[model samples]
Target: MARPFLYRCPITGNNVQGLTSDDAAAEGEKSRLEMVQCLACGGFHLVDPAKGPLPPVDDK
Candidate 1:
């Protein structure tokens, strides 16, 4: 089952949410690389799930 992951876009600096593989979800606490497609920049980046998925931004 896929799980949610989060990362910051290097190009856009947007806190984006993404899904991870079943294996990755099982090891979410571990340091592993997850490639996230940035919603703000439309670029691909590799980020560690351990470091982020920062708290929900207050857009208001």
Candidate 2:
């Protein structure tokens, strides 16, 4: 199976996977900023590959 594309939630620093390039492209085209709600932190954040992979932050 193909590995899923992953990104980090800028707000909570949680790892978010299962997002495909097509998904990002569609979102990017729709808005100036592609924001996604973090399932871990429940906060909205931007996904940018340029930021690199970020380690998950502890909420506590």
Q: Count the backbone clashes (under 3 Å) in each candidate.
A: 0, 0
Model 2 lDDT tens row, 1-60: 333446776655557763324433454454323466567777766765434456666579
* Candidate 1 lDDT tens digits, 1-60: 877777766666577887777663454456778777777798888877667755555568
Runs off by more than 4 Å, candidate 1: 24-30, 54-60
Pick out the ten consecutive residues of candidate 2 with the lowest summed lDDT. 18-27
Q: Give all candidate RMSDs, comma-separated.
A: 5.1, 6.5
User: Candidate 1 has what TM-score?
Assistant: 0.63
Residue 44 in candidate 2 has what lDDT? 66
TM-score for every candidate vs. truth? 0.63, 0.41
For each candidate, the alpha-carbon lDDT, in order, equals 0.71, 0.56
